[model samples]
Target: MRTGGGTGAGAALVYGTGLAQGLALVCFPAASSILTAPTGYDLSPSRYGLMFAPQVVLAITAAALTPVLARRWTLQRVLVAGLVANLLAMVLLVLSQAPAPSGGAYLLLLAATGALGFGFGSCVSALNTFAAALVPGREDRSVLTLNVLLGLGTALAPMLIAVLLPRWWLLPVGVCVGLVLAIAVAWRVRLDPGPAAGPTAGTPKAVLPGRFWWYAAAVVLYGITETLFGNWSSLYLSGQRGLGVATASAALAAFWACVTVGRVIVAVLPARIPATAVYLLLPVLIVGANVAVSGASTAATAVLAYAAAGLACSAMLPLSISFAGREFPRLGATSAGELIAGYQIGYGVAAFGVAPLMAATGLALSGVYLVGAAVAAVLAAVAAVITRSGRRPDPSVPATPPVTTATRSDVPERP
Candidate 1:
């Protein structure tokens, strides 16, 4: 397949997906800090946890099933449908909350949250998966650069929301903006219209074997760290440590600012250092931050800790996903979605659900932090072992064998 020039729009969509995922990932992470039991939002702990729970499961199911679904619908069409649904859900939730939120209001919140989660979830998984497959080289710049874009979104979403919410309450506004972008680009842009766009396997493609499960586990473990810090940062500072909401919000924003920096730094030399080194570095840096948080005698220490930990974890997930995804092109969107599910489950277990049960350790926040460090340690060891002994197959991205008619990618699928 010959191509037309779209270096600009293609780049924007990639950046935009980063924005959408950043917002989707942080949508609840942002609100959970502000909308808790004390805030009188009437959204129970169980309800807040429930908002992410079903969405994670459905995202995994959607990621895997998206290939089949895409056979009939264009990827853009699917994205547009989900975006519209998400916008509706956000508007409904905002209206329900204004005059005084209720139990019924919480239900509406969850339903809308699920729609947005799945839409963002599916679009991200599809685009990233396809990018990995379609790139001309296995370890290509575009595929790797996506980590930077993703980091940009994740880091920016919280800070942007935190900064803007004070003036315009931009949750509704951000969703509206994203809906327009998704609609505009989904029509104007096309991402390599070929078999490279989706999964070709009927069932259980054997190229990756079972090693991808390790990748899934690594992400879930990594997510625990992110959840503990992201969902509970404000609470830890304000509720436990006796800081003002304004001070805590600044700490959280600073953390993401550091994350954006960390990703760009690590991205520069990703191929030089081994994956295991990045894995090992994360927990070590996080433990150092945890020490500061535990002994945050003043506001300055807390802010420093948040920033350091953000940089620590900034690149962990994208690195793991790239390493794990190298062999499993057939899984495509589903694999990405499943890993995200793993991420949410681990995050939910620590932040909203389990941490509350261990009430002794300052709502079990410290204990969860310790547990997350331990999980990261285990993943480093697991990654070391897998690097040495996993199913080794040729991972070369298929060459564009002279395009006569069907295109190089359509040649009976090479693994």
Candidate 2:
């Protein structure tokens, strides 16, 4: 495990882990219909949302502790631990389906989600670090490639559910096998993610730079906007628009498919577009898509609107992490970990708060999309400020890698 670099087998495993993680992360959300249907878990809206509360709490804790744990446990050990947690989560989810809807079943689901939170927190943070190091100078593209795999897994989940229906537990069973494979690979590969951060990175007294807070805030807001679609799109379509379960599932899949395809397009686009430009423009698209989705009537319109929302979400998170990585090169894994924590905060807010807000305000799911549009607008404003700042890479390090065939035009604006 202490003998390999971040290429060849190790890189493939890292990317595969991303796909597996995507599948694991979306399992609960993808089964939202089944979990709440009369024939299924028979949960109320608030209860459905409340299921994620423990996940949020534990995920934040695991993610925020990555840098601290990495100092002693090493990134490899931390990743292995995350994988084991993920496996336990999938196993519990499968067991949860054995009993009919009852307190025992619900408790199993809660325990599974809590484990998933820890797994997602630690696993994703480490993967971001490894992905950034894969291509040396091309951190953004590398991360985008990894996320493409992740988005593909997410897209596949609901489609599988649409096909499998009541047998959705099989999906996590497959993911369990995948996790087992990933854990084996983690054990075999060292996955050196360049160099570790400076000594202060692990110190209890140390803090991230003030400028990093803007990126954190932007991601937190972005997380809320993303979850509004990821967690609620199916419910909105089936319940509000009178679409069938299959149609709603297809719409959700469409959103994730576009997210994958959009990242691919951005990664290989010929134009030397500034990353900041993409970052700022996406939130505007999100705003429009959210408004459109809220008013959609037909299934076609709902699917298309959600697809647009997915495209808007495609590259934003990777870009944010990459940007912060470039600005503060020495922070290494800590930067990604902290940003993940921020995004999970937003995730928690949207996951639990939406139902309560709807109940208190007497607004429908459509109105929630409208509110998400406002949040996207705020995200746009934050992106504008980040772009204007235009922080350059560290002066002590070389501006470009000494390796291969990438020309000046292939790279995005560094900041």
What is the C-alpha local distance difference test score of each model? 0.60, 0.82
Top lDDT hit = 2
Q: Write the per-residue lDDT of candidate 1 for residues 187-233, one digit (tens) a residue.
A: 67665522434444353332434677777777777777776777677
Candidate 1, poorest ten consecutive residues by summed lDDT: 403-412
lDDT of 2 by residue, 331-400 (tens): 7778888999999999989988888899999989999999999999999999887777745444434654
Clash counts for all predictions:
2, 0
Judged by whole-model lDDT over C-alpha atoms, candidate 1 comes out at 0.60
Taking all chains together, each candidate's TM-score versus the true structure is 0.79, 0.91
True lDDT of residue 149, candidate 2: 89
Which stretches of model 2 miss by more than 4 angstroms?
196-206, 393-415
